[model samples]
Target: MDFYHESVLLKETIESLNIKEDGIYLDGTVGGGGHSSEILKKLGQKGLLIGLDQDIAAINKSQETLSQISDNYKLFKTNYENFEEVLDSLNIEKIDGFLLDLGVSSFQFDKGDRGFSYKVDAKLDMRMNQDSSFSAYDIVNGYSKEEISKILWDYADEKWANRIAEFIVNARKTKKITTTFELVEIIKNAIPASARRKKGHPAKKTFQALRIETNNEINILRNTLDRMIDRLRPQGRICVISFHSLEDRIVKDTFRYKFLDCICPKEAPVCVCDKEREINIITRKPITPSEEELKNNNRSHSAKLRVAEKI
Candidate 1:
């Protein structure tokens, strides 16, 4: 399927980056090159834009779209979790700016075959990278009931996690839960009818949790944020667009810790820890999409853009 992702907080992110004409920039999640195209437009011929994405479709689509902008652009077909390795392989020492738009792209969801959406009745496959061995199919059919419960509760914050996990375990005992519809039915059966009537979809949270676990999305984002910060040059900015609260929490906490001057308790007489501040939080609060953006694209409603400048 053709790659497509609505760039959430596009103008806010671009402005937050404060793009320099000759600066080096990186879009760690270059889905469809939407933001990259804008960043490149603000750059001079000497400037560079490094793009990374695990999805082959994103890589191909972004490459094709970004090619027209400048040869100064480079695309990496790798997870954003490996941002340091990506930079090292390219002989890039310090990045002037970087951006990460976390979570699955619109293409992954809307493209019927990828199976990222519970709304679709496709096969249960949610591997961001096609080469990855683990998929939603494996998790549903192979994982223990306890593990499934933990995944849904922790990742999705679903109140019916335990019931859903029990239902899945029971259903799979008869036959492997191999399709989206099968899993959706299991989720519907698990959730209380009264509660299901209030929310958007019964399967939404469970499916989200499974996809996150399958891709190691939360852990990867948590681990990579600090390392990515380290690779930035002083005054350089890192802009992250997070779709969910889990991803946003990581970005928010990381930014706070990096920008904090003191690690000591308030009762302490003198500062002991010699931790130096690495960044200044550019967005005191994450910048959400404007009303117009939301009206035009419903996908941007949950999106939040957080930026921090290296100190």
Candidate 2:
């Protein structure tokens, strides 16, 4: 399948970075190279754009797309969590700006074989990196009911998590839940008909939870934000576009904490902690897509872009 993903908040994200013609920039999740291509357009010959993605398909597709723009950029087939190592190997101590678009590419969901969508009937395999040993198959068939319940509740905030977990455990006892459709059936049966009718797809939250757990998305995002910010030069900005509430909250809290001058308790008379502020929050609120963008691309509906400048 061809790699296709509409860049969400494209103009807003690029503008937020305050791109310099000769500065170095990084696109941490360069899916389909949509955002990276736009960033490349603003750069001169001296400017550099470093692209990173875990999916080989994305890397290949991005190469095709970005090569059309310029050959000055470098592409890496690795997760953004390892971006620090990439920079170290390249002898790049600091970058002028960076952008992270946290949405999964449209190709992943639309390609039935990837098993990211509950609407698909393929084998349950939601590994973002096709090379990863762990997958949705392993999580669904191998994990304990309690573990599955926790993953659903914590990652997706699914209210019927316990019930869905119980149903999965029961169904797998007869035979392993090996396919997306089988899992969807279990989810539908687990959720009451009235409740299922009230919301969107009955299996949406469960599938999202499974995909997140399979990819370790949330934990990696949380761990890498600080490192990405640290690699920014003074006055350098980091723009992150997150798709869901969970991701948005993490970006917001991380930026808020970094922007704090002192984290000491209010009751403390003296500023003994003396925590130095590392960043200035550029977006007091996240930037959402325009109505026109939302109408043209349904995927941008949930996107929220937050920016912070290294202080």
Candidate 3:
């Protein structure tokens, strides 16, 4: 099966941007240009869509995909966290909108050799930027038990973090855990038989934690929201599509932080703490896929789209 990262919440995401025909926009993840192509369709002759992706494959794929739609787009080979540099390079002062489709793409997991999926028995390499030297292999084999445990808990909320870390450490002492299946077997063994039978695959959380660590996705997303909002023009929109609770929480919290008018406690009458609201939270609650969309794309089951507009 040809696995393209089908854009999740395509209509809602496009509508959230409230596309301005002659305005400038950015697709920070540009995975396979699924959203970018749609953004391209909404752009007029003067409007421009600038896309960025750390994965070279995505950069190339989006370059090909968006080209079919129009020539009014540019793809950059870098992470969204460094979007400032890319914008400066192009002399772009501010953008009218920004869209971030966060987390791993379907293409990465489906490819198998990239190792983002637990079902795939490929080597444990989940580096979204294939050029990067660090990968799941390093974390699985090289990280300390404590570090591994923390990653599983903090990144994935894995209940079996400590036990899984212990299992990984003990198993590696006998032999290096080099492949995806090797780690998957260790996770299955570490989790109790009852817990393993609960819900979803036993190795899912462990794999997710490793993938997050390998790519430093959590920190990047945490640091990027404010900067993206800062770069947006007045009344500009920022749309984020997050795949899991961890990511959805970050997006929600960031929007909440920006939506705040004052943080002063109710007890204090004076306003000493000068915290200013930044953006207006457009989505009172995150927008999820429709029943039809959920039925069509099982991978999008956890997806949530949250939007905010610059104040």
Q: Pick the candidate with the highest TM-score.
A: 2
Global local distance difference test of model 3: 0.91
C-alpha TM-score for every candidate: 0.97, 0.98, 0.96
- Tens digit of lDDT per residue, candidate 1, span 1-311? 67888788888999999999999999988989999999998999889999998998999999899889778888989998887887888898998998988857889998888889988889999999999988999999999999999999889899998899999999998999988988999889988899899848888899899899999999998888999899899999999998888889999999999988899999999999988889989889889888899999988888989999998
lDDT of 3 by residue, 1-311 (tens): 34378899999999999999999999999989999999999999999999999988898888888889889998898989999999999999899999999857888988878888889889889998888999899999999999999999998899999999999999999999989999999999999999999979999888888998999998999999988998999999999999878899999998898888889998998988899888999899999999999999888888899999998
Query: What lDDT is reached at residue 288 by model 3?
Result: 92
Q: Give per-residue CA lDDT, model 2, range 52-122, as digits (tens).
A: 99999999999999999888899999999999988988899999998999999999998999999998799
TM-score of candidate 1 relative to the true fold:
0.97
Error of 3 at 66 (Å): 0.8
Q: Each model's C-alpha lDDT?
A: 0.90, 0.93, 0.91
| Model 3, residue 68: C-alpha shift (Å) | 1.0
Candidate 3 weakest ten by summed lDDT: 1-10
Model 2 / residue 221 / CA error / Å = 0.9
Which consecutive 10 residues in model 1 have the weakest lDDT in total?
A: 1-10
Rank ordering of all candidates by TM-score, starting from the highest: 2, 1, 3
User: In angstroms, how far off is 268's CA in candidate 3?
Assistant: 3.1
